[model samples]
Target: MAATDRAEYCGIGIRGVAIGIDSFVWFALLFVAITVTGVVTGQVETGAQGVHTSLSGTPGSIALGLWVVLTLGYHALCEWRFGKTIGKALVNIRVASTDGSAPSLGAALIRNVARLVDWLPSLYLVGIAGMVLSDRRQRLGDRLAGTTVVSD
Candidate 1:
């Protein structure tokens, strides 16, 4: 491949860094939401030892559902509308169709949804392996969605 062709594909290290940044964002959101919910619902209780937090029943269920939507929706909306997440944008990478065009919503959804499989055997072992072995450096989700993570 020519230099430009090679430049179009992002490798594992940068992708991993992008994901790490994304995870921090997710964690921060989760922490804020949980803290706010605990405060509003009085889910945090003072224990003999120290401060404690607990949630169950309706509140717990609602939190769980909302988290799922927010987590998935964050990726889907970002990819479909901008072709990249905040992390990917910061890292100067993007998710694009194999044909080098922006991915459609359906394609982006497929890519994000396939994360379930990509995470198999813990910590994306399979997905990492696939990226390392594939010519395009794609994960399972990228392959399934007919997309690639590229430098921008």
Candidate 2:
């Protein structure tokens, strides 16, 4: 790819904003599912009693597990199928290896798996700092996976 195809920054700021938006949406969906389940179960309670209640019901566990599945599984599937997330699509950006090709499954998994570390210590400061400091705008995960986020 031509140098002009790249930007001085990898657009992590924009990606962060997109992630915030997605998180809000996911939270809303999860809340709705939880609410619906509670209503159907007729298990609604009031005040601090509700707070003390445990979500140990099988249905509740399944719903919670599905939420987790949706979050991680969706990202993996989207990266494999479209080379980006919905946010990346909106910004016309994609994640690829430094070689300017789609990242391999191993690379993608490695980068995503390292997200736990990138998100360490609070608010993804480490990841954000790495993106800002690196000449290629790569976060720690990107560096580890030999990947880069680029605009199409």
Each model's Cα RMSD: 3.9, 5.2
Candidate 1 lDDT, 1-152, residue by residue in tens:
43335556887799989988899878866766666667778888787897666778887776666666676778878999999999999999998888777889998898888877888999888888889988888899889988889898
| Residue pairs in candidate 1 whose N, alpha carbon or C atoms collide under 3 angstroms | none
Task: Give the best candidate by lDDT.
Answer: 1
lDDT of 2 by residue, 6-119 (tens): 533456777786677667657865776666566666655668545322355686886686666556655656666677877777777778778776778877777777776888
Task: Name the lDDT of candidate 2.
Answer: 0.71
> lDDT of all the models against the reference?
0.82, 0.71
lDDT of model 1, residue 31: 65
**Stretches > 4 Å off in candidate 2:** 1-9, 28-69
Q: List the residue pairs that clash in candidate 2.
A: none
Prediction-by-prediction clash tally: 0, 0
